[model samples]
Target chain A: MNEVSKPIPVADAETAPYWDGCREGRLLIQQCADCRRRRFPPHRLCPHCHSANADWVEATGRGKVYSWIVVNHPVPKEVYREEVPYVVALIELEEGVRMVSNIVGCDPHDVAADMPVSVFFEPADGGMVLPRFRPATGAA
Target chain B: MYGLRDKYAIAGVGETAYTRNSGVPVLDLAVEACLNAARDAGVDVKDVDGIVSYNFGDSAPAIAVATALGIPNVGYAVDFAGGGNAANLITLSAAAAMEAGLAKKVLCFRAMNGRSGFRLGGGREMLARGVTQHTAPFGWITYPQAMAMWARRHIVKYGTSAEEFGSVAVTFRENASLNERAMQRAPITMDDYLASRFIVEPFRMLDICLESDGACAVLMTDAARAKDMAKKPVYIMGGAYGGGPDQGEDLFDAIRWPDHSENYAAYIADDLWKSAGVGPRDVDVAQIYDCFTYSVLMQLEGFGFAKPGEAGAYCASGAIRRDGELPLNTHGGLLSEAYIHGFNHVVEAVRQLRGECGPRQVEGAEIALTTAGAMTCGSAMVLRN
Candidate 1:
């Protein structure tokens, strides 16, 4: 597949730590101090317990494809046309938080629900290392 | 407990020709629909004092419509957020205004050049806050992608196949084929639906709504005054609009929420049915939002038409077809008909109850249920002749 110009994510106060972990090859998520539940897309308050107190924890980075889509349409940037058909997957991590990411290292059509995956960091636009998922078997 | 129930009636309904490209500004479409509705209601354009449009910010503002139509002044104008939610909320807003004696005649409309002008297909920012901050970076930008995830999960859990989803497309196409105003009137078979291209996996091209350039408008007033109007006033039996918990949160993250299938439609079911003093059996026709085919399937179960995991089979059984027990989307809906957001559904619901739909009219249709799509929020209206 041709390299598509991917949109780089700018880290914000709530999500910066997660991006920082991706840069360092650590899959980090927020853990609620009150209920001890983990969450993705870091927020100020815990969605489960509604507690404001939370801390970061490194994840195992292993997950299963809860659901997926093969996007046949063009992506945001014009450069993404070269990669017309790409895999956009929702991965349910072992820690029980589901996050959206691309499934690399496999044919776009070959990916299916419940496929095993692992998080990997790749250099993206803006000198940022983005975390994407790949087949757990290291197919690429 | 719904005080506005049966107090207000739809005085008039008007729609511009549904097309893919109008080549005119959305403002023009707004004026045409609003003026047509005013003319249909037998009310002078200068007499309309209240105006309301959904807060999409893509269409002509209420004041803009009023100014274009030469209205003297505006009273009780509102433009609230949420696209499909505005379908019922705007009408309900008009009803509330009439109840409060704020305005006599109220105009509610939705106008968009969705295909030729401003397209919802692109990944460009639509809503800037909340979900976009997380989903956009991953190319999870459009509604199809988000809704596809929901469909995919539903399929995995219920063994719902693509054929079942295609049935909805076929059913709507059949309905739209009889509707001359619908954008796509060609009948589609299940094979055609299965053969269609996939914009997003689990959601074929046929499953998504057409992005058309058109608009639809409705006029509302007190039920007692509507008795002498140009057309039969479709009384609003009961209506409700609300959302479930964490509606804006990531869908996949909350797979464990009480009942995974309980969307806003499911959550608001009790209020909708109870206030209307009717059940699923009493609904002669239903215009459930068809932004995507799976949504129709979900809403079928959400509104208590079928048990969870049984809607797919219920659809396959041809219950939603024209001659079926519960005729749905008789005007083809957004899937085949023009996507005037969800306002087109409202117009179709009114027309069916009025017996104006000659070929596709549901026999003895006395009550119609019009619903908006499930878009982080939803709204529903139960109307009776």
Candidate 2:
């Protein structure tokens, strides 16, 4: 695994199970047992229904390019300098969750809003897999 | 408007120098001014039990400040997570805490040299971490970039020109020059605004705010508790907060289904108005955020002060000047003043209500309306003496 100081997400009893699932390389989202609406970053309750009844399920990992920004500038000294001028975006995951992520396999300028994309997990620091995006096959 | 009427008073205000090249640490500067606020309010640091700031806050500022001021068992502490809305959000939270009796005094602040320290314009770090993973590649890389694209669409609809956009920069400088706290305090002409070097095409260097390493803070407390403090209390008549347009499926999705009419820029204006239980005409003094010139323009229209494109003309008419009917950003603004997000705007509003600002003071100032900028998630307060 690549060396890193590793971000220990605030994983307590409420979040432990979620991280355990991520360790298995499966994307899980919280949905209101009552409303059946999906939400991201794993919360305690449903934003819509406020129901507590819920379970974990694998996401299809298919989403469209909702909004994005192409970062092509100098690197912050604190971060990996080798990753300079990369394209970072805000992907609206198919699960109705918006996450900050980077779009790989393309130039920064090529990123377009509404572009079809899918998740492609990449090896990250601290023996974990990070979610990234790639252009979907035959996507608009 | 976040319900500020004489319900609470801003007892003190302080700031550090605004400069990007300064080698000072951001947290130290922030703490320095916070302690200064303690003195300005005619109280010792030990009196501080409530501290509310932006979620973007660094722990160093508050933690070190607590230790330095000998404030023990802080009854209230929070960091509201929203960009640009830091000051206003803090105000709302402070007022709430005061109303709840959780604390007798609350201090709100924003401190950073995002320009000097973070180098957000570089965007490389945010990109590497893959934050904002799906925005736009060729465009919308930074705040100005994202706003520029939004502005492009408005120009097409409103027939507003780049020069019209330039008017925001001109107004900011005109007001900032008179403000000693402002960084880019220089006399600016419309021609100079247009002709100045372009940082982003159509967005001139003059149009953007300065990058500075500084911190600013304001102290607010219950209206009753304020009487014993050094400064008179400014009531919190109203307070409101609004969100920005939801992340649409596509850029066209945003443009096609703009829930926030051009009159209010985006949804935050709608949220603020609803919270205040009033509309645009209720505002007496205005302190609209000015991260860039267009931010002010969009906010003016978004807040329903004018029509979509009418902001350009309204600003040009000197209505937003320091001495104008709707005096604005009398401490300059992020553009001319230090860019500690929108923190200073709140302080300036309090000064207006207290009648402390001599030449820039708006006489008989009773109410102040402040708004955070686009992608809006800020709190607005109507303050009256």
Candidate 3:
């Protein structure tokens, strides 16, 4: 057991599989087995249909920058100092599911709405891989 | 739906001086506010059997306040969890308890030492758990970030300009100059607002609310019992608390994800007016919760003061000024006034209805509307003199 200096995702029973999928370089989304609608941030019962039964499915990992905010102030935290003035964006996947992640591999100021992006995994401090996004440069 | 309409009235409102440093404990602030509220209502501390506050862990609990006040017992007490979302709910709970004979004199209050002790925006945590695990790891930990997202989407859709956002901060600062208790009273121009540094893109330094050390408390009782109180009663004409689409279960997925132009308050806009038996035009003053300037724009749309993409123009035309069609946030709101969550707005609503806000008062103000935090879980109330 090791301590992680940065805040990492503490996966509970409901979200463990999704985090596990991220570690495997796959973006896992929840699809209701009955209603067959997709959801993000993981849930037990289907948010759309209230069906207790659901399945983990891999997503295309491609989304558009639905909206974003470039934080210019330095948060009063030692761990977040290096990441000052970072862009935190709501990336909406092609499946119509949205997730919050940081935009990397591009200038934070260059981020814009409807800009194409793709999921990219980074090794976090907790020996786990966290899913992030980079600007989509090539064709789907 | 309107059964509780006018059933309760705010008998008294009290608050500690807004300051950057209180040099006291949060519990002390809470007790001071409660005692002042009880005195304002001409009620003894012993008569307050119902105590209610927000569920946020910042303030002293209801039982803590009662114990410190030397009350023997409490018939009803609840601490709701949402921040500004719980402002009006605290009073609504007190009113309901008093009307049901659960308690005679109910005390609702909020106290915080945000500047001296802990700043709500100075760290990497959300008020509630689970919602920010995905975001906080990436420094997306503050409310302004979410609000920035909402603002950018609105701008892209409606062709809103940064000048529109500056107008909101400028209006609040202008009103704050008239409020002696306001934290920022230097006054600002649209040029000053434009030149301010950006905290979160689309939101400048002036777009955010001030973090001050203060407290606000109000006493609630039945309308019939309010006539016997010392001050003139401010009746609770109507109130509603509710949530909108996709906010229920997971809480992570929003109704329209990045586009949060629609809010929970809009769902109950008609219901609130119908309950109060008035329309938006009847509101003489408004104290809208303004965590960010853009949020005020969203709320104007949600509460039907302006059409979806028209709030920017509406505000730009000076319609929300102190002498405008709607004298909004006359106490300067959180942008310039102290932020005790949204409780300060409620106190201002009561003052406007009673015609106690001297320089910033809305002329012939018979009705007032105060809205809690918007976009997420929220609440609103209509008050009448």
In order, candidate lDDTs are 0.82, 0.65, 0.83
* TM-score to true structure, per model: 0.93, 0.71, 0.95
Off by over 4 Å in 1: A1-5, A47-51, A137-140, B126-130, B249-262
For model 1 the TM-score comes to 0.93
Q: After superposition, which runs of candidate 2 have C-alpha atoms over 4 Å from their true positions?
A: A1-140, B1-5, B55-61, B126-131, B136-140, B244-279
Best-to-worst order by lDDT is: 3, 1, 2
List, residue by residue over B80-168, the lDDT tens digit for candidate 3.
77678778878877877776778988999999998898788776542223655666666676667667877878887888888887888
The better candidate by TM-score, 1 or 3, is 3
- Which of the CAPRI classes, incorrect, acceptable, medium or high, describes model 2? incorrect
The RMSD of every model to the true structure, in order and in angstroms, is 3.2, 6.8, 2.3
Model 3 Cα lDDT, one tens digit per residue, A55-78: 898999999988788888856456
For candidate 1, the per-residue lDDT at B309 reads 85
Rank candidates, TM-score, best first.
Answer: 3, 1, 2
TM-score of chain B for predicted candidate 3: 0.95
* TM-score of chain A in every predicted structure: 0.89, 0.81, 0.92
